[model samples]
Target: MAIELETETADGDDFVVYNHVAPPLSELDMQVIKSVPPGGNWADIPLSIAQKSKRIMQIRKSGGRTTYYGRLRNDLPSYTVSTYFYRPGNGSFVHPEQDRMISVREAARLQSFFDEHRFLGPASSQYKQVGNAVPPLLGRAVGVTIPSGFAVDLFCGAGGLSHGLR
Candidate 1:
């Protein structure tokens, strides 16, 4: 079930494709995405503009602190993927350059899932599954102690551990 992806690289188009698909962004989502600058978040927006949202207004009025409505820098690792990643206010889920939320495939890659690892269910469900996953690198490190040829994953969701075990 591996899908080939054609990505343009410095050399040329990379022919490696990933099986993962991302959920599409809505028009409002696109609008919200365009409002963010690279490595910026809703916090960077003018107070007048952000105040339209009750959530932002309440947070500001309460004098509470939050890293929500932020963006990830291209040079840095992503914030912990949360189940609510569909909302930009939940975390820095926006693409560094693209004006949209990070795709399911991107999230999977961040979690160290192989390109061939496929997720089941709807897009939102896929995001939740990926967000709740243990990083494959950590899984590999933990798997090193298991007896050769015998491995078990107690809470495998998207096969991060099982993939690493292989």
Candidate 2:
């Protein structure tokens, strides 16, 4: 639940090159993100404000998962990290208390990336890098579950699972 950077950064510890910082939100975006609370989702937004969104309107009328526009809960495991974690509309990427999406480093922490592992490139690419790869801890769990057994992983990217198995 807690994370630490491997080294000192220009922005200090909580915020490194790819940590703590979040994208700016539009006025409407701010309203929507603010409406949700810890463990709350799109359904938590007031009807007046929620109806403004074409997608939210559709989901409201028809039906959809509440995962959209969701915030994290301290007592629960984090929702799976996705490539669009920088966008709250994409998933439950919002911070429980802050009115912004989780930062790249936060996503990486959820994905169990090592503190020493640095991601370079634009923030977008950094997010993708964090989301696309399997968590090293998950890989280690899989490896431990079937000790001494041969397994072939198809289309494995980053090979964290394979590496952990070895």
TM-score of each: 0.70, 0.76
Q: What ranges in model 1 sit over 4 Å off?
A: 1-29, 63-66, 145-166
Candidate 1 TM-score, C-alpha based: 0.70
Q: Best TM-score goes to which candidate?
A: 2
Error of 2 at 136 (Å): 0.9
Lowest lDDT 10-residue stretch of candidate 2 = 1-10
lDDT of candidate 1 vs native?
Answer: 0.70
Model 1 Cα displacement at 134 (Å)?
1.0
Q: Would you list the C-alpha lDDT of every candidate in the order shown? A: 0.70, 0.80
**What is candidate 2's lDDT per residue for 39-104, written digit by digit as tens?**
998888899998778988887777778798899987899988888888878889898777777778
Candidate 1: tens digits of C-alpha lDDT, residues 1-166: 2333446566875545443444466554565567778777665656656656787667667754445666668888788887776677677887777666667777888889876687878777887888999989989998897888885676489757567555
Provide C-alpha RMSD values for all models, in order. 7.8, 7.0
